[model samples]
Target: MPQNQPTNKIQNPETSVPKTPEMNERDFLNDMLTTEKYMTGSYNVALNEASNQTLYQDLATIFKETQDCQRNLYNLMFKNGWYAVDQAEQPKVQNAYQQFSGYKNQLPYAVQ
Candidate 1:
């Protein structure tokens, strides 16, 4: 039986405690998928804060590619039953859409 060790001394139900032995595919994919998420976020930030138009476009393209990669990884994980995704409630989704669309056309932010 695999031992389920909590990441910290106190087990947090909301967070995952990765359990993979012999460096399994689930472990590799989870780590790569997670790291790609961070990379995508960094690319998005660079795109938003880029003072140079060329740099901004380059980052935007890279961000899109990273996003596609993340999606593919996620799909694979999901298909293999290695990833658990919780669907958002329709009301919650509607509320978020209303909130965000309220700021439509607003500049992402003032460039520093």
Candidate 2:
């Protein structure tokens, strides 16, 4: 062991954005997952704050986008004729979308 040298140092990789468009199924699915995560986060934060109108609107938009992405993804899968017999988890996704829509509908409206 050298006395003057640094030991066991880990370095983080540089963050570079992807330049090319992703056209594959895996890439599309990853994008959908990312959008869903962001939407859920925005919705939770808006609910937490409870008073930010801008955040509330943003959350609503994100919620719509996430739901649309999910639905379209499934539709594409169905279009490709890939049917799975074990699909107990799909209803839950629909339920979540309905619940989020309900929440959006119930938001307080102030006439200014």
Candidate 3:
């Protein structure tokens, strides 16, 4: 009855209903950063156990690239306010250092 009004619009049953997207860009980037972190950890283990120089160099390169990618993603998320970090206090920092420093004496082999 009014102008610019739809008059009994027909619905198309053949057209499939669109599903909502599972993740936003921030979620996707966070996932990539997390996955890169796991890959970097595995690469560190591989590098430590590798006997061949060639394989070590290859893994090292990949590890470096993965770290770089992770940093970039982190920077992007940080800029977009998708990631948050807490500042460390001097006492907490010194305590962590002192605790880990004590572990040096527990090494299986001689430090020297």
Which runs in model 3 stand beyond 4 Å of their true positions?
1-21, 97-112
Candidate 1 pairs with clashing backbones: none
Highest TM-score: give the candidate number: 3
lDDT (Cα, tens digit) per residue for candidate 3, span 18-75: 3557776767888999999899899999999999999999999999999999899988
> Taking the tens digit of each residue's C-alpha lDDT, what string does model 1 give over 7-105?
322221333335655676777888999999999999988887899998888888889999999999988777676766555668999999988776664
How well does each candidate superpose onto the true structure, as a TM-score?
A: 0.62, 0.37, 0.66
Residue 13 C-alpha lDDT in model 2: 36
Q: Between which residue pairs do clashes occur in model 3?
A: none
How many clashing residue pairs are found in candidate 2? 0
Distance (Å) between predicted and true CA of 26, model 1? Answer: 0.6
RMSD over all Cα atoms, model 3: 16.3
Task: List the pairs of residues colliding in candidate 2.
Answer: none
Top candidate on lDDT is 3
Per-residue accuracy of model 2 over 1-112 as CA lDDT, tens digit each: 7998644432333233355785666456546756766766766766677677887787677777776776676555444433223334667889998898888777798232
lDDT of 2 at 107: 75
- Best first by lDDT, ranked: 3, 1, 2
